[model samples]
Target: MGGLRNLSGLDASQLVIDGDLKISGNNNLESIADLNGVVITGTCMIANNPLCVGCTCGSIGLAAFTTSTTTTSTTSTTTVTTTTSTSTTSTTTRNPAYEGDVLCQSSAQLADAAALLEDRLRINGMVAFSNYDSFTCDVDATTLASMTAISHVEALEIRGSTALETLAGLEALAAVEFDVAIRGNAALSNLSGLDTLSSIGLDLTIRGNALLTSLSGLSSLTHVGGQLAIQSNPVLETLDFMTSLGSVDFLLISNNPLLTEVDALASLTSVNTLYVFGNDELANVNALRNVTIVGDCFISGLKDCVSPDACSCSDL
Candidate 1:
């Protein structure tokens, strides 16, 4: 349309401005606010004062908006989930809900969502933070610190954040039922600071931590209301803290070589399937000998199942 400014101040619903609004002749056309949703065409090069909401300028070169309601939370803890080594296809899985009171979104289109978060999260509907779970960003542990501007979210899936190296800003999340998946972040080192994350009453996944040497810091991760699967963490040598666990159904930990001595596993008598595979260093399958193996006992890599007085792996 020739006149892009025709819809200005128009209460017309679903008004869409296709092209960039420019004052061709007026040199004194001070910056203006749309006071309504406006879509821009092509790249827009406007000063901070000229930008408007819903301004879909091409590629967003340099634009800033300041509203008193723009909530900014500072980073308090600097923790990161471990990395993964193998190629695995992601499956569709729904986990528990909010670990705290508010859920923050990094890409707030409405611009003032934080102000309504407390209100929308009244009964059940979660305030969509960042609208992120639907897409993936190439962020790693080292860069997670820069996402401090990201607001609170009840549940988050940065699993596809290839460049994500840190799990910092998440300590502020106080929700009870949360599902966190940071699977594919290759450079993440340790889950040390995630000690605060134990408060998560539901499922938690720190899987794919290929270089993770130990799980000592996660000793606090004992009481999960649901399943806990930490598969393919090959370097996780010790599981010292898991003895405190009261219940678990599918406790899958495969391909972890250094993780020997699961005697501490007695705590999880409630688990139905205890998959311990590809663990070469595991010599004693006896720690699990006493427990009633209701399901398959995948202690295959062991040199041999301990001989119980001559039965040679008796079927008890």
Candidate 2:
């Protein structure tokens, strides 16, 4: 079934398809959870159904398909064949999951690092790179650009890279299963490379980047499962790129001296703890007036803005 504009459900669970299975371009399609037990003998194609959630063939327990690009978006495609079988046996071919940690500390290891990430699409452990005072080796954006095959990692830490100016290489990263910390990268300017990242399973901390000026790369972020902290980025000026962010657990916006407004938090409707303080230039926080917070809040250092009492759940 392809291009069926109103097709919203496919209950083919435990069914066997002898021919190629194609489900694509259904504009109103939403759920494919029922297709989890499907067995396809021929190739499978499921793509471009804008409203479909968790629609990937691999996500539904079918064999992983060969695709040039992989993203968390609904517009994903999969195509691969399976052998004919008489029994009701099933197997899932998931992307390779690396069990060991990956660390790329220098330029000499960049090629090896890229090759390792290219083969392991999912890393079950941490991926870290620390270039605090390494004058002998350089790990810049160009070094990270080679590792595009990595789609998911348990944790990611990039710290103190003087040569790293932008996150232009991590474009293929879609999700972080744990925390993500980017700190003390003095030359780093913006988050322009994390454009496709949609969710974070835990905390996200951006701290002490000397020249960083914007959060422009996180435009696709929709859900942050834990704390969202942006602190001590002296020149960081706005939260504007976080327009797509809808919910987070603890929201901490502290010490970003140049940050003047949080108007982009208008899309934020769900949060637990809210701590906005030490931002000397912060004046406009009218956006927090409509946010729904279920826990405590501590807000200060603003000249003329709504009080935390105004955002109390009791008022709602």
Candidate 3:
């Protein structure tokens, strides 16, 4: 069964094919309904079949095919009361929607999930990729580009992507209504892909990115409706790129080992709660001269300072 082009007339529901089963490049094939109870030995290569959805290979047993039988019953009364029942015992069955989290490990699976998200957003105005209310991506840069079509995600997280050097191709995403987190991405060095994002309705967190050197990509971000925290980035040396940000409900800058200057936040004037701690090289809070309406302020661990007055502050 190698190069036949079409299988429209083949109607075998239960089949046993020995050796490797290779079905590829079937352009006209849409459904594999006839191969429902089929069994194949060795490997299964089912690719380049564009129209296939929810295709599964039956389980392998001993050295032959094992098929399960299902039964159905229907009863009707004189008043037209009908009852139907179905019972089956199968080795492999398709899971229903209420099973659990939908795992999307491969790019193809992610594409399918993205399409479903797009559909849900069109009908419902918002979508959470899972029960957790966030769309999580652990894919490479190429696969991440494929996600640019998604625009209505409530929350987003990009982590564990080794090949992501820049956040490019996500130009369509302009808002995150909840939270946005970029963490634990070793090769991610820039946030240029998020230049279009101007606001975050909740916390904005950037942490645990080992190779990130700067926050220049976030230059367009003007407002953070909730807390703004930048912590644990090893080589992020400055916050000069976040100059446009003017206000936040809370602010924190901690544990960024090489961050020495923060004049980028010169425009920021108001914060309800503020904390600046554990930044080894942050000599003073001079960059916060414009901050006049702080509800609460906590400052510690500035290497070049001895007291609150020594931190170029007349009051705390």
Candidate 4:
């Protein structure tokens, strides 16, 4: 059965399926624990159920089964395929190994790279791509859209792509286990693709993108475990999208020539070290009125500013 949008759970304790059993596209299904005694002799396919947080065959405590199944739970957006043999002695869960860094320097390699990432869901290493010298290749929107299935990565870097205008393909990317650096992508104007990214395990650096105008796509980002540096972007004008960011280990906003004010940082409550400098158009930092710094605070190069010993300043 599929497309049962309102069905929350299954409670058939003694259910048995002689043929294939497909349970899919159930948006609100949360538990299948009551199906613990279910017996299935054929393939069992469960996919696209968004709210099934931990509803797995093992989690359901299946009494007896002999079949192969591929389960894709949207809770974490990861796919797991398991095979149960007739011997009942062992159940082998197969997780394909797609390890190491992925580099796509040319357009020719983008399709294969995207396909590999889409199939694997997550990667153990970095994903870096740049069209620095390749006049025939560009990491554009379509190329990034093909990688929609990638939800997590150890690290990600998109740099120096002249034809890349926007980050429109990474809507499903929810987290970065480590750093995420977007730098020197000359034609890149806005971060529109990372709308769902809520956390970065380590640093996040946005630097030297010649045409970047705003931090628009990071509205869901709340935490940066390490540094959060926004530097040297000549045209970057605002941090308005950072309303959800509350804290970070270090916060640095420097050399953004057109940044006039930091009103977007009003939600920032904590930081280890805070540095705001070299922003030519910036006149005041009154927006940092409530930030509490545990380590150090340095403010300079604004039109008007005052150093507060305790890291709170309302008059700039």
The sequence of per-residue lDDT tens digits that candidate 4 reaches over residues 29-88 is 765656655555444555556677665555544423323454333323336865543311
Top lDDT hit: 2
**Preferred candidate (TM-score higher): 2 or 4:** 4
TM-score for each model: 0.48, 0.65, 0.59, 0.65
Worst 10 residues of 3 by lDDT: 91-100
Comparison by TM-score, 2 against 3, better one: 2
lDDT of 4 at 45: 54
lDDT of candidate 2?
0.75
> What lDDT does each candidate get?
0.44, 0.75, 0.63, 0.73
* Candidate 2, 121-217: lDDT as tens digits: 5787888777656632346776677657678888988888888888987888899988899988989999988998999999999999999998889
- Higher lDDT: candidate 1 or 2? 2
Residue range with the least summed lDDT across 10 consecutive positions in model 4: 87-96
On a 0 to 1 TM-score scale, where does candidate 3 land against the true structure?
0.59
| Candidate 1 segments whose C-alpha is farther than 4 A from its true place | 1-136, 140-154, 160-166, 173-178, 199-203, 263-266, 285-297, 303-316
Where does candidate 4 clash, by residue pair?
167-193
Model 2: runs farther than 4 Å from truth? 1-96, 105-111, 133-138, 304-316
Return the TM-score for candidate 2, rounded to 2 decimals.
0.65
Better of 1 and 3 by lDDT: 3
